[model samples]
Target: MEHRIRHLSTYSYDPAALRVALRLKLFPVDHEGQQVESWKVTVNDEEVSPLVFSDLGDREALWSSEDALDQLTITAEGIVSTRETNGIVRGMPGFAPPGIYIRETELTEPDEAIRALMGEATGDDTLSRLHALMGLIHERVKYLTGSTSARTTAADALKDGKGVCQDHAQLFIAAARTAEVPARYVTGYLQMEEETEELLETHAWAEAHVDGIGWVGFDPSHNLCPTERYVRLCSGLDAFGASPIRGNVLGETKESLEVSVAIGQSQQ
Candidate 1:
């Protein structure tokens, strides 16, 4: 699968905002399942270059303003070729053993309900248990756009039974980790088939480490594993940590953001 994707965001900060800065994880690395054909990130109108970590292969960049600014615009565009790996993630030039993912963040901390969910999952092994857990979460949560915020925790989403993909992923991760399975959050793009797939924005999902299979991607919101239509991005212990863009401002002010993502599939 070939995908040409562009993510554009404009931040309209109030005049009270004096300065701003951002950390970008916009670059994608070539891995066993995907190949980066072309990619770039721009702030306002200037292109910024990010460096890949020598030890981890994670790409990162920092953008800041030297003068006072009231508004900012950022754009990340790229083309990637992907292959269906049957949800099996491999050959990625990075390392953070599964133990690191098992460490829970505030957003993924499981409550009594989530822990009970762990007990409800019946499977022959770790992989099958995760699959059962995925199905359980998808059945429990209702996918509602704008129903939850960035700060919503897995417990909150599960109790409410409503949220976006972010909530689904976090809930799944929380439950998995509760069962002693290592899981993490993944943020990326999904190329939807208009007639068959739900059109979603800035996709988020979960990946769990299986004993014999390594890391496997799962989309509990969609009740399926990630396929060729998915483009893997950065991941972390939780949603907040895995965000593509993290920002900071110097003054007290209200911030309004407008975001747009355009994904075009090619018949190649």
Candidate 2:
């Protein structure tokens, strides 16, 4: 599938002051199952060029300005072609190591419930157990739109029994890690449905490092692996680490935010 995407994020300041700096992770790179055809990032209608990839193999850059303004907008637009690789991520390098994801973060700390969940993933082998775990999570948590925030942790989300994609992904990571399986958080874009025209946000999923097969993707909330309809963005120990954009504004009394996203398939 060939997908065209546009994402616009705006930050507004109440006092409207001095400076703004943004750390960006909006660029997507070509990998085994994904290819970036054309992409660009812009600030306030002006194009930004020469974004550098981080040491961890992420396309990242920093944008800053000193001019006082009411709002700052960052826009990323691109065309990408993707294919289904049986949920196996390949040909991507420099991610520290597969074992590193075994470590936990604040957002993915496993509690009693997650440990119990992991214990319930009964199977003859690792892969079977992961699939069983994903099924368990899917049945455990009910999907609720806008039911979670950035600070919501896996334990909290699991206990609450409701959340968005992030919650499901985090909970899966937490549960998988409890069994000593190497797992990580993944951020990306998902074409919700063939008839769906646009979306207001990106998607989240989790990846577990299987011994012989490498990293395999899983989405507990949706109960499926990422496919041709999904566009990979970045990965981290948790959602915070994999966030597409993080920023700070100096000299602003207060701040507000608005985001818009659109995704569509190319006719040609």
Candidate 3:
């Protein structure tokens, strides 16, 4: 399916006397089952510097310079090609180290419960093992909106027995890692069953590295891999790694952010 995506992230400062820098991962790239037609990003404030390059993972680091700043806005729009390959990731150059995704971070870490949850070993079949893992996690954690925050870890979300899509994706990543599978977090857009004329903004999921399949996508939230209706942007170890948009500051101050997203289908 062909899709048109728009994402606008704006930040407002309480007092306009500080500097801001931004990192953007808002552009979509050609992936196993998806293609990017055209994408662009524009900044509202010239005070904020442009992005810089960094060799971290699949994503690029765009760093903004430190200068006097207040409010900042980053907007992105483009067309995306999406499909479902049943988690079959193909045509990737090389393999990412397992440790790069499993290391403990601010929002991702396998705790006692995660360890115990993943302790029940399964067979070696990649698809079957992933399916079993999905069942176990879905049964363990209930799906509820607004039950967890972006900072919530897999253990915490699992304990709460409910969380949003991000939490579900993170939990799946953590569980897959504990099971010795290399999984990464995905950020993208989802088309729900709403009758409204506007499309939703972004979505999250997990992709595991299978022996012969490379990377296979999985959405524990829906217990399925990404279909043609889903548009993928970027991925990382966790949300932090695949944040749609991020910023850094020289000094501390109060800030407010407002986001608006719209997705639509286009004539191919």
Candidate 4:
């Protein structure tokens, strides 16, 4: 399948004065299952700098804020042709060996609740445990957008009973960690049907480590493994680590952001 994607981010500041700069990881990458047809990024202010190369996990860009500038706007547009695979990404470019991902992060630390959850399920199979965990999260939390923020914790989201896709993925990661399973966050895109709505923001999910197999993708949001309709970008401990974009700050006092994405399916 082929898809045309456009992602636009605009930042408006309450007070305008000096300069602005940012890092962007919005570019779709070329990999086994996907091909980048054409991609471009444009900043409204000509004074802004262009993107540079980085050896980080995913595509990145740097934007600098000089002086005391207030307003900032960023836009990204692209087209990509992608093919669906059999639910598995066989040869990921930089995947660490099987044992590495099991290392735990601060947020992913396991607790009693997680241990108990693990105990209830009597299977050593990582895939089975992963599916069970996904079901637990789906039942625990209701999907709602504004109830959670980027920093919401797994326990917090569970208690609040609401969060978006990111929260669901994070909660799942946290739970897996409690069970001594290594899980990471995945950032990517999803192609929707012609009548479907909501295609602007990037999508997120989780991956768990199996004893023999390396890292594998799971979308608790959809209760399935990633397929041809999904586009993979990067993976890390959580959203903060796998953020699509990051940047440095200058004298700018305050800023607001707007994001829009348009994804369309084309005849293969």
Cα RMSD of all models vs. native, in order, equals 1.8, 1.4, 2.9, 3.1
RMSD of 3: 2.9
Ranking by lDDT: 2, 1, 3, 4
Better of 1 and 3 by lDDT: 1
Question: Taking the tens digit of each residue's C-alpha lDDT, what string does model 3 give over 104-195?
Answer: 55576888887777666365686678777777776778888778777888889988889878888888888788777888898988766464
Clashing pairs in 2: none
Over 120-154, each residue of candidate 1 has an lDDT whose tens digit, in order, gives 98899988888999999999999999999999999
Q: Candidate 3 — which residues are off by over 4 angstroms?
A: 45-67, 92-95, 120-124, 193-201
* lDDT digits (tens) for residues 22-92 of candidate 4: 66666666666678787777666443323553443456667666566565667666678777654555555
Which TM-score value belongs to model 4?
A: 0.84
- Per-residue alpha-carbon lDDT of model 2 for 1-268, expressed as tens digits? 9999998888888898578878888888778999999999998887876477765558888888868878888899989999999888888856567777899999999999999999999999999999999999999888999888999999999999999999999999999999889999988888878565776688899999999998899999889888888898888899999998888778836988898888889777
Candidate 2 vs candidate 3: the TM-score winner is 2
Better of 1 and 4 by TM-score: 1
lDDT, candidates in the order shown: 0.87, 0.87, 0.73, 0.69
Residue 182 of model 1, lDDT score: 91
Error of 4 at 206 (Å): 0.8
lDDT value, candidate 2, whole model: 0.87
Model 3, CA-based lDDT: 0.73
lDDT of 4 at 55: 41
Off by over 4 Å in 4: 45-56, 65-68, 95-100, 121-124, 194-197
